[model samples]
Target chain A: AQSVTQLDSQVPVFEEAPVELRCNYSSSVSVYLFWYVQYPNQGLQLLLKYLSGSTLVESINGFEAEFNKSQTSFHLRKPSVHISDTAEYFCAVSDARGGGSNYKLTFGKGTLLTVNP
Target chain B: DAGVTQSPTHLIKTRGQQVTLRCSPKSGHDTVSWYQQALGQGPQFIFQYYEEEERQRGNFPDRFSGHQFPNYSSELNVNALLLGDSALYLCASSLGGSGNTIYFGEGSWLTVV
Candidate 1:
């Protein structure tokens, strides 16, 4: 079985400050990584994903995550964040070998990012 | 294009009663997956449907069941609901392939008392 661990439960930072949300996973085989954001009373939106080729992936909202194979980590980072970035972020993983409709994702508990003015 | 959509945005039910939730997958998506999100917890996979068949399921009890229609829409039915069943039920859709991006709906909020 595969699982994701997000070390931070809550991270508070001032607006325009840089932040990093840590994530680690445990899997026997290679896996695809993804980051999702959820705002209050809304569904999740994909921030970015790391399927293959590039280890570093960026989202249009100035957020990025780097997939480190050996370390089993895909930490999300931003040089600066806006108040609109405040939300709960989740790290998820799925087996790279699992194809077709059999694919399923395992997600972390989630990290709440609060950007204050 | 419209994203995934779920019906009965909010519902209240009593224990031992049954409840049903509906979902319409995003355009161009063939696979629909259901998830349960408890308060303050990440979404937990319930099952996935493709070609009108269940392709994958999570560790849920028999009380939890689902169906997919020919149009790729899906429904989640819960029998003998427990207080613990009260949560946000999310529906997601994706292309039937490995490493494909999955889009989620706002979710149906169920309250079991």
Candidate 2:
């Protein structure tokens, strides 16, 4: 079984300010990490993922996250946020299946980011 | 080029009544997964269907069941629904059977009265 914990329920930041959303997970086996964003009443959109390359992975929209194994953390960060970035962000984990037929993701409660203009 | 789509964008049902939700996978996709999202909570996996067979399921009860058609579309049927069942139901699709990231639909909001 795998579980994800997002420490903050809400975060408020002014436009152009940096922000970091914390996420931690507990899993017995190797896992794949992912970040997803959900806009108002919309579906979840993939932000970035960490699957075993460099410890850090970045999204095209200037968001990035670092997977810290020792700390059991995968925190999402952005140097400066735009108003359009305001949304709910969720952290997910799927058990690593080197060769399996199906894999499902375990998600966090989500952090609501509010970027004030 | 169509993404995952769900029907009856919003629904209202009475307690103890049953409801059926539908989902259509993205074009060229063969796998479909369902999830339940409650207010202020993350989405919970319901099940996954591939090749018209149930491949994986979550911790939900037997009261919740589903089926997949030959067209790769799916449906979730909840029997004896309770107020707790009122939540956003999300459907996702992936290209292959597994190891691929799931893409989600806007979700259907079910309100139980």
State how far residue B69 of model 1 sits from its true place (Å): 0.4
* Candidate 1: tens digits of C-alpha lDDT, residues B1-78: 899999999999999999999999999899999999999998999999999999889999999999999999999999
Task: Report the lDDT tens digits of candidate 2 across residue range A1-117.
Answer: 999999999999999999999999999988889999999999899899888879999999999999999999999999999999999999999887762323678899999999999
Q: lDDT (0-100) at residue A104 of candidate 2?
A: 79
Clashing pairs in 2: none
Q: In candidate 2, how many Å is residue A63 off?
A: 0.3
Residue A76 accuracy (lDDT) in model 1: 100
DockQ for each numbered candidate? 0.63, 0.62
* TM-score (0 to 1) for chain B of model 1: 0.98
Considering the two chains of model 2, state its CAPRI-style docking category: medium
DockQ of 2: 0.62
**Model 1 agreement with the true structure over A21-101: per-residue lDDT tens digits:** 999999998888889999999999999999888899999989999999989999999999999999999999888885622
| Candidate 2 residue runs with Cα over 4 Å from true position | A99-102, B97-99
